[model samples]
Target: MSVSPFRIALIVDGEYISAWQYLMLERLLASPHAVLVVVIFRQSVATTLSQRLNAVLLKVLHALDGRFFSCKPTAQTPTSFLPLLGDVGCYAHGSKRYQTFVSTQRVDVAIELTGQAVLPEMVASTTHGVWRHFYGNPVHWWDDYTNIREYARRQDEIVSGVVRYMAGQAAADCVFYATTSTDKVSINRGVERTLWKMADFIPQRLHELATVGEALFQRNMRERVLARPLSSQDAVAPGLITTCRIALRYPSNFLRKLYKFLFRQEQWILLTTSHGNVTELGLLENFHKWIPPRDRFWADPFVVEQAGEQYIFFEELIYARGIGHLACVRLQPDGSHTEPVKILEKPYHLSYPFVFKHQGQYYLIPETAGNHTVEVYRCEEFPHRWVFEKNLMESVEAYDATLQEYDGRWWMFVSMRSHQSCSPNEALYLFHADDPLSTQWQAHPQNPVVASAAQARPAGRMFTDAEQLYRPSQNCAGVYGRGLNLNRITQLDQECYREEVVSSYLPDGDFDMNGMHTLGIGRGLSVSDAVYIHRRLGRLDHWIGKLSGFIDQLVWKHCYVLMVLPLTFLWLDM
Candidate 1:
């Protein structure tokens, strides 16, 4: 006989919902047999009506799409009351006044995201019980170092008391944990109990949950990767911020610095191709006074020098979004250029113009991150026409890939934020580019050359100056968001590389109070050095984005201040 779908009770303490959790929720609910019961903890009466309605709307949307869920708001209880003696919170007990609510419902499994302090006795005694402690991993637990002291204090209080640990033992028959290493060796020690590798758990009380949330996690990954549309075009958010600023902020900002070092001193010429208000390539360069007739966004400038002849190939964005085709322009020695000539046009979007020559053969590499696969192209005839030769680095998750030839070996590096735990999965993945045309790409045994999501990611090619290699990367540690910390890769080899804080652009000169992300980088004719193009997606990006801050402020104020009205509505609805 086929098994009935597992009934899942997703327990959330308050307003924290990770992208990974959201994706897995959708996947688990994808099975028609499974039922999702979302238990939302309402801590305060001040939450806004709109916020409450939206929360219900979210559950309703999921239910309408085939999920079976209900939102239950209990009283705001303190973590101290829980019987569990662990760092996590407790909420297993029904609200003091809501005993009937627990008696009326049957939860097959109670999966707690990260409210370890709230797992009460009433909540634990449910049938076939299980709880997923998402914060058990070291990588994620230290995402905010500042919260460590506060969390540690709470942990001591819980362990000293017997209720917390005992409640944990009594609540669930099984415990599911996600962690890379134990606390003794790895940085994330003592945050929670890990049953993954360690056998220190009380076997008599809890069985290990081996459900391998892999399938569930993969579904979530696919949704995020496919959600972004392939084509995109926007002005290189203005400013001449140094590479150091971006590298220090976004972890991928170093690519900008490496480029500047390689070509910063040369005098290059400027050639304006199409004049359109929608296009931003030239306006940021002080061409805003005169408006052109054509409304098209051009690709990053492509420069090639051979036998005293320089050729430039750029993309034209026809509708201000879709990348049209490769256009070629001839450049004079003084940096002056001829009219741009359209060369090749493909149905797919393309940008990040990269051109290199080897053994008399010219090749091009574009930011094919949107294609979800890596591909290389060969110049069939110069300027406009080319043909796709091979696809490299298949079945990998990454964006913004750049290739480099170093020490007689070819290396292809890309930025990837892997699936599952999201503590800066943005790391540099290297592959051996055996042949220009062959797709036989081999990953370096140490796959992730750089692990710091705040650093190691590339904004462009690992540019070189005087035989010394340097990379432009983003630095994201310290603050939530602000400016870049341009880093210089002093040394790189098979084992690892060292980066130096060349310069940074943190607001108020505080390195620990800002963040930055690099978008693109390349060598241009106008300047001798490699120009790294970047954007500072600071806290302003979040607080100013689509009224998100306003919505959050309204929600918090209303939910906490005017709770009686919504409570009445809920009581009536029930």
Candidate 2:
């Protein structure tokens, strides 16, 4: 049955919008269920001298700072978003033209794109009320400048998007929430990346609201993932003294960067437990370590046991090649290991070798996100040969495809990104099918079941013990792959999904440890991976140091990029 598309109206200040905001409009226009019926240009407002100066300063800093990380807010052009703005004209909120147009076109939804505060009258006019975004702390102003505050606090940013419905005249609904970490190196990339990802959810939610009526759409509602709405005590911008104090730390950071470039090396190694469940991983004494050579990193491990022999499969990425491939190593009885053998290699990069035995046949779903595919492989010969199976999902930026058979169906948990500009480590998507090898998969009603990077990326396989289901995930808060989050699934189905973290495991600072992410348990053994900031000079580090020296010489000779490039860690974005 063909249904009428829901009428969508955009509230904007002329044609000015962020590049990510333009992306949201294009996505909405592309959705079959949403029609951009009108674009109401907001009433013009004057900018104060201080506001103008602040804007210029922000632009100059961003342009200079973007060289370190090639991410900056895009300058706008009319032709870029003009086509998507249907029937555009300037109008006040309560103008006669606005009312007549809304009544005639039957505008179903209103989206605020002007960075304005949500008004009570906006909901009273539109049928489905207004949709707006708040990109900062949960309980802050609409357009809070949070990068400085978050950098100063060393905390993750909770980026939120909400829909204000006219239900008895109240505006408190955080419909979309993603609390993700900023970039470890550049906060500009971190902030921009988090905001760009919303291009996926804003339109997807509209489709759901139009396809399924409001009653069924909100039925079996998932848990609210945001903190309280904006409170009056929250300051929109940080204090000047506080920002100045934060900026003074850059000198120490610059010194530390030199030391790190010359002496530090980050390495990932595999760890195996003698006998421990997924929930309780036990102490360091229970683990046997497998350290790879300094040239390669072995991660995303999976295990298989056969006839008193154990085979460990993982992704091995050489530092020189900068690409990952599937490899396997045999575990010896005396807690030693044989050299790893190349298992599978393709033109594109691969990782997260999710192997399983279904219908007496061995299958593996390695992360082929490089090819934009969630591919399954069947083993023609054990531990050596693998042939192509079917593509479970195509044209998706999905990572760590983990499958579990539960409640008479097969559920797949995968982290996904909307596009290249967005980060995939913050959202967890769910899909289900009748059989493990089913060709068609059904997406959950609430697509992004979990939207926090702290535990969104799957770390290992899901397991059941004592009639309880547990899923392990990577803790990418402030840094990627920093720890393990052990979560218990309270509910799961097509309509709704929920999970709660029960425990956490972080590196104990032994051997200069920094992080642990992947985990797998089978046949009385639990295997995991840990990363350490080892103090050793490798071939790669040597070249980086050499390059740093060259850049330093150029920076010293010319004062052009001195304040911006040489003192790279500045007040612009920490």
lDDT score, candidate 2, position 7 = 78
How far residue 555's Cα lies from its native spot in candidate 2, in Å, is 26
Q: Using lDDT, give the best candidate's number.
A: 2
State each model's CA lDDT, in order.
0.41, 0.72
Top-TM-score structure, candidate number? 2
- Backbone atom clashes (below 3 Å) for every candidate: 72, 0
Model 2 per-residue lDDT tens digits across residues 337-376: 8899998988889998999989889999999999999999
User: What stretches of model 2 exceed 4 Å from their correct place?
Assistant: 1-4, 48-50, 75-80, 86-92, 102-106, 138-146, 163-167, 211-222, 226-233, 242-246, 282-285, 508-511, 536-574
In candidate 2, residue 149 scores what lDDT? 54
lDDT of 1 by residue, 1-574 (tens): 1345555555565445543344444444554445665353535335466545544543333233222112121111112212212233333335753455456666655555453344564355555444443222321211112112212212111010001122345332112221221111111222221211121111201211112132432332233224221222121221112111211222222443454355332111123333322112222232211111245544345556665676766555566655556667676656465777766666676754667776798888765655666767888877567788777656655655667776566777776644422332235677676565557766553345454434545543455444556555544333222233445556444433345645544332221112233322233332111112222444443333346436534543344344356678899999
